[model samples]
Target: MQMLPLNMAAVTTVAMWKAIALIGLAVAEAFVVVSSSPRERSVSTQLASEYGASARTRTRDDYIDINRESGGPIVRYDGPTIRPLSNVRAPSLDEIWESTMPVIVQGGSLRTWSFANPQVDAVQVLFKSEGRPIDADIDLWNGPDNTPHKMRVYVEDGARRTFSAIIGTPRGPNSIAVRNIGQLEFPLDAVVRPDMQDGLAASIASVVSKAEVIQGGSVRTWSFNPVVQSVAVIIKTDGRPLNSRIELLMGPNNSKQVVEIYTEDGVERPFFAIVETPEAVGSVIRIKNTAPLEFPVYASVAPYTLGEYNFVGDSNSFNEWHML
Candidate 1:
């Protein structure tokens, strides 16, 4: 009787295992069915459509449709008649800025141009591709700070894309870069204009402030033979986001003053103090930059006086404080 019960128990266990195996197989088949659905496959096409109205949904069967379409950069209509202008414009290098150039970038490459003068307020990029659509990112940097403003663009092959502007500050040299993030290599005609005409006259006539600090950090001490009566310091950080502590010391030992300032991310910190001396005495000012990052500090001293624009030019630590 005990043996019979043991056999029955073995049979029950086998039946349970079979049921579990069937359930697992059903789940795997359901997952496959969902993943291969038409809805899942259309995701990429939907994303491409959102980039622009001209962007077409590309697919394996749609290869003929893409090829039938003509691609090239868009031409600007500058006259009464909408005729395509010649890429080869004025015969002089000085007039090259008013023309377009044919640029071919292979798959997975980037082109960078540091052709912008400080007067260039913006850059205009108009491009069209042949055969295959091109995907690229337009990068603009105000200076060599390595921080770039990026915009993603999609170009339909054989069709002209609308020109896009990369805006930047008119201060310092700007770098315009185009990165091909797509897998296809094709010829593209691009009209890139470094627009410097707008506000050019105004910029030339405008007086640049001498109060702007050059660079900060490193050397921090300044000693003057006859100490100034008062000192002020202004600290501003670049956009990289930083937290730093700045300590300033000024005046002689008898009436020495120490000011402690803390800077949080994105905020400018300031410090000011006056020195009291029984007589004309030598004074030293010290400043420190704990978060020593490039473009970390913009410093300026107080009281307009005829002194070196970089008054603290000799200071080893901070460039913002100058001996009057």
Candidate 2:
């Protein structure tokens, strides 16, 4: 009788241990399944039929849609005769602006130039690729809406020069085109406002009374930019410790901007000046000179529009640029 009881207890103990072991294993497997959950992936197709035409579903079908678009740059076109897109990933701002030139496309993929509404389809890239750029052009067009528009583009001289321009609203979307019969002499270096200034240095004069204060962001690494080649930055001390700098920014594309900081001592080295952008309309360069370190700084811009037009030029703790 005693032996039978002992044997029964032993069998029960073994079964209990087996059950606990199985339960532990189940818990472990559950943990592994949860930990190894796959990440949610987003779609990136140039012309996916699902962009807006279909009810695209996300694995994380959270109703609150988010615009977490991450992928290579995109450039597309649509018109009476659309051609296959070329390999234009994040093309230079100058390249895109060239399409705005007065181009009369007669046949093939070549059509009259038109400034595509960047806010809708693309972001006007203002700078070219890395290195000194050698390619350039200008495209012109007549608006299909009985208006005319013009665009000037600085080739992605990679890094040869910095080109920048600021247009008043009157020169921008105000009208399709400015029908001024007369043309101005560009070779004289007398740049016009609101158009592509290619590569030149001009002053806004004393706009302090007309200027507004802009709060700045963080500093970033020092990188070269094609734009802002020759620039004169005039800052009002306004009783602050913020020292301004001249940066050789390329574009707002990939890679951080490059810079050649000029101080009151003047530019220590010769800044290679590329004239007549896209072509040498009359390219020229001036040897390095003293950069004004006065309360109001002055810089000369040329080459192409430096990548970072954010005016985010700030000083680090020690006065070095802090790339934001």
Candidate 3:
């Protein structure tokens, strides 16, 4: 065979092509390795990083033991851990204003109770039936403002029907009246408690980062940064009240706490829950509204240093309060 002189330009082009191919191959391999890593495989881990959750582990001392007793019914601590206002105390039914009224089928009867103290902020209504399901239409009135506050038309079956409403402002006196709308007659029990704004305000560590508007029949997730001890979500509709389902998920295992809020034709209401301890991976809050109307929502996460506290009086006391 006869040898021919080499073309340097052609040789250089081939060499460059070879180098580019090798570089591309290396980059593809790196991408595959990163995508298949254990950390990247976890959706929660990725979400935590995206939300700026701290990876550092928290010490036991960082948390306050609200329920120190070791071996009874394990009640997890949720809410703000901080000390409440000086005047704030656990809600009590003993010192509340309560009254009972007979249910009238035709023109619903009304029972009004006067509050000597003007600090009452919550009202609870319980319906007692005589061996049958009772249906009633209850209306709450703020006597000082002379305006109708909350109204509920519900059926009380075997279980005792208890309804609670939060009063936004302090009033001189209020009255709740129930009318029998169903066939069965029942007695209505109403109780009122003072507002918990002072205690709840003292527990809030920071305002919500942002508010998200979600359409009806849709679900949205809110991730917290620097995981909080507790979270309170305020859901507001334009003019009608709707039912909402909330889920709180924490840790790598994604432990869940669920809360459901059902309201009538009202302006706004709040739903609150808390985690026993802070999670390094942060927490995920999911809200689902099944109503036909869209609404606006915002969540306030309680500070880790102190959990929020509301009056947890008798089993029937309305404890949760709006953040003022």
Candidate 4:
């Protein structure tokens, strides 16, 4: 090999290029370390926590959990979730108003009553007996046309039977006829009312009212007045047990803050709850059933009043009614 003279300038330029490449690699590594640091991680974790909290507040049974093995957050949802009734359309007050009267029927003859208002769409007949089992048959006929629009037969033993029937088209005048076909005389109560649509809408709009018989697997919601201090909910089931849940929404944003579970064993029971501080302008209550079969369910709400009570030495206590 022949020896050649070395160029110092060229050697210095190569050293400079190597130094620049090493500096670039160091800068890239530093950038990755800063991105994965505790401060950055904490920011992302906080954002996730806030999102989870907001989502859980809107639903009845949704939450976040941490995985034990992996130490990672997991979201879980157990449903039949309750929702607000703010957007539900309700009936007018006049539609639900009932002009109820007492009716008595004897023998196997039919008795009819002509509507004083002339313009009506529906009729409700409620029959009750105290002695033996009785059967009642009811029919509704529209005036002028004398068209038999609706009819029903009810057979029950010392129990109340209510039949609500509708007339297809509006009429100038209408008549409702009821008869006791059983061996016993029946004492009954009758209500001449408007269509059910108006009544149902009115009930949902009012703060303290009764709801119609709700079928299984259906959900209903009611709104409360702002001045209400507390509310009492009464539920009645027809024949089978009812598995239901109630959710209460509070605050302006209507967050699901309170929850109640109800199991009705073919009986009437009342459930009550109190309002929290900084009372909500309005609150919403939702009822949902998890059963597969359809059953008759009625719910009503009323304001709670506090009164004085005197406790005697015995197990019984005397309660006095007084305005709070």
Per-model lDDT: 0.42, 0.29, 0.45, 0.45
Which parts of model 4 are misplaced by more than 4 Å? 1-99, 116-118, 143-145, 158-169, 185-187, 193-197, 200-324
Residue-level lDDT tens digits of model 1 in 1-324 = 435688899999999999999999999999999988875334457656685444555444322111122341111112211111113221221133245564666657787777546665555455555646656666665555654344455544423222222234345476767777777555454555664542211221122123343343543554543223323334445554333333223334321333333323323212212222111233454545555556455444332111222111133212333344
- How accurate locally is residue 115 in candidate 3, as Cα lDDT from 0 to 100? 47
lDDT measured at residue 286 in model 4 versus the true structure, 0 to 100: 65
Off by over 4 Å in 2: 1-125, 139-157, 160-162, 167-324
Model 3 CA lDDT for position 124: 40
Candidate numbers sorted by TM-score from highest down: 3, 1, 4, 2
| Model 4 quality (TM-score) | 0.30
- lDDT per residue as tens, model 2, 135-218: 222122223342221223323343444333232222122322212111221111111222322221122222112322323322
How many clashes (backbone atoms < 3 Å, residues ≥3 apart in a chain or on different chains) does model 3 have? 8
From the highest lDDT down, the ranking of the candidates is 4, 3, 1, 2
- The positional error of residue 105 in candidate 4, measured at the CA in angstroms, is 1.4
TM-score of each: 0.31, 0.19, 0.36, 0.30
- Tens digits of per-residue lDDT, candidate 4, 8-127, equal 778888999999999999999999999878763343587889987797686522432233454432211231121222233532221322334456676576788666564444343444
Cand. 1 Cα-lDDT: 0.42
Best by lDDT: 4
Q: What would the C-alpha RMSD of candidate 3 be, to one decimal place?
A: 17.3
Model 4 Cα shift for residue 81 (angstroms): 22
Q: Which prediction has more favorable lDDT, 2 or 3?
A: 3
Per-residue lDDT, model 4, residue 142, is 59
Per-residue lDDT of 168 in model 3: 35
